[model samples]
Target: MSMDLWEYQQDEVMSEYYQELCLSEFQERAIDEFTAERLSSYYVENSNLLVDSFRALEEAQKVSSLSPTSGLIMAAISIEIALKIGLLKPIVFGFVHSEAVAESISNAVVKQTGIDRFKTLLVTLLKEISHVDIVTYKRSGTKLSLWDERGEVQKRRNMISHKGSLSSSQDCQFAIDVAEAILNELLPDVLTSLNLHLQNKVIVE
Candidate 1:
C-alpha cells in the first residue's frame, strides 16, 4: 500500500531482470561499446520515473473505490518512457562517433514524438545505423516480434493518453507487463545489437 514498498519491489524486479540479461553475455559487451556512464546518465532518471509511475499504479489499485484514471495515466507513461529509453540508448552509445546521428536523435528527443512515431523512428534508426529491422526482431528471447500487437497494450495506452479514457485493473496490469517486457527484453536487445554494430564499424574503419 505504500509507494516506498512499491519502489522497493520495482527495484528488485529490475535488478533481477538486469541480472538475467547479464547472463546472456550482453552486459559486458554492451557496456564496453556503449559506455556505461553515457547509458546510465541518459537512462537512469527516466527509468526511475517509470518505476515511480508503476508504483503509483500499484498503490492506486489497493483502493477499491478509487478512480482508475491515475493508474491508467501512469501505465501509459510507463510505455512511453520505455519507448523513449529504447530510442535514446543507441544515440547515447553512438553520439560521440557520429554527430549527425546524435543531432538527429536530439531532434527526435526534443520533439518527443508520439509512441507510434517513436517506434517508427526507432525502427528506422536501427535499420539505418545497424541494418537491424526492429519490427522483425524477437522479444524476450522468443520468436515473436516486438510489434506483434497481440497484447493490445499500446491501444490501451493510447486510449488513456489521447482520449482521456481509463482501463480496468486487468488492463492496467497487462500494460505494466508489457512495459516490463520492453524494458527488460526489447531495449537491451536493440542496444546490444547497436553496440555490436558500432563496434564493428570502429574495427572496420
Candidate 2:
C-alpha cells in the first residue's frame, strides 16, 4: 500500500482500538537505542523516588500523631508515581515513532542503514520539535503528529493529577498495554523496511 493509504488505515484501525480500550495507541515500537537508554535511566531515577517515598511512609506509620498526614502524603505520592509511569509509556512511544519514521525515510534515500544514520534521524527529530511554533507544532512537519498524541497523553496526565481520575489499577495497566501494542505493530514494519534487526537488548543509561 501507499504510505498515505497505509497511514490512513493505521489511523482507522488504531482509532477503533483506542475507542474500544479508551486509550491512545501508536503505530510502532521503533524507538532508537539511545532514547531507550534515556528512558531506562528515567525509570531508575523514578524507582529511587518511589523507594524513598515508601520508606518515609513506613517511618510515618510508626508515629501516631503524624500518621494521618503521612498517609495522605504517601497516597498522593503513589498516585503521582502511577501517573508518571503512565506518562512514560506515551513519551517513549512518541520518541520511538518519531525516530522510526525518520530512519525509514533516511534509509530509503541512502539504501543503507547504520546506527549513526539512525542517531542522525533522532537529532533531526529533536531539532524539528525545538524549532516549531508551539501552538502550530502539532500540524507542521512529518514527526509533528506525535506531538499531537503527546498532547492527548498530557491531558490524561492532567486529569490524573488534578482530578484523581484514573478509575482503577486496571485503567493504568491498560494505558501501558495500549502503548506496547502501538509500538509492536509499527516497529516491525519500519525495521523490515530498513533491513534492520530489532534485537532484544537491555537499555541501560
Candidate 3:
C-alpha cells in the first residue's frame, strides 16, 4: 500500500522516537551497572582475628625439630585465616549481604563431603575480596605472589600430613617467612588496624 506524504512523515517520527526510547533505556542500565557501592571499613572490629594469627605464626617460628613441621602447617593455616578475616571484613562492616555467610558455610560443607570441586580457602577469599578469578586478581600488583607460593606451602603441608614426610627446619622457616611476607604485603591495612607492631618482630622468633 502506498502512503501519503503525512503518513510517511508520521512513520518517520515514530521510528525516531523508538530509537531514542531504546537509547534512553540502554543508558539507564549502563549507569546502574557502572555505579559502585562504597566499601565499608573492615579492620576495626575484627582486629583481634588478625592479631591472633600473627601470634600463632610467631610461635610457629620458635618451635624446633619435627614439631616445627606442625608449626609450619599452622603458619600456613594462620595465613589462610588472616585472608578469611580480610574477606569477611566487609561483611563485618555490613558491606555485603549476611546471607552470603550462610551460603559460604553450606558450600564448605558440600566441599568437605567431596561432592564437588572444592575451592581452596585462599582462592575463595581472593575471589570474595577482589570479585575476580585468581589470575586476574594476581595481576592487580600484589607483591607476594600468594597464588603461586601458597600452593607450595599447602603441598608441603599436605605431604607432611598425609605421607609423614620429614620436614626440615629450613622448610618450617620458609613457610613462616612466606606467610609473613604475604601478610605484610596484602593485608597491610588489616595489620595496621590490629596495632600488632609486627614489623619489629624477629624473623626467626
lDDT for each candidate structure: 0.49, 0.35, 0.49
Please report the candidate that would top TM-score against the real structure: 3
TM-score ranking of the models = 3, 1, 2
Model 3 collision count: 0
The CA-based lDDT of model 1 is what?
A: 0.49
Return whichever of 1 and 3 wins on lDDT: 3
- Higher-ranked by TM-score: 1 or 2: 1
Over 4 Å off, model 1? 1-68, 92-110, 118-121, 124-133, 137-145, 148-151, 161-164, 191-205
Full ranking by lDDT: 3, 1, 2
Writing each residue's lDDT as its tens digit, candidate 1 over 1-205 gives 6569888787566555533432343433443444433443444333342354344435444441365555555655555655554454434434333546544434334234454533544454556445657677654555656555323666766677788776787766655555556655565555564342113112110
Model 2 residue 143 distance off true place after TM-score fit, in angstroms: 23
RMSD of each: 14.3, 19.0, 18.6
Evaluation by lDDT, superior candidate among 1 and 2: 1
User: Once model 3 is optimally superposed onto the true structure by TM-score, how far is the C-alpha of residue 143 displaced, in angstroms?
Assistant: 11
Residues 48-121, model 2: lDDT tens digits:
32343334334433431343333333343333332232222323334433556533332232222112223333
Over the stretch 27-62, how does candidate 3's per-residue lDDT look in tens digits? 234323221222222334333446666777877776
Tell me each candidate's TM-score: 0.48, 0.26, 0.52
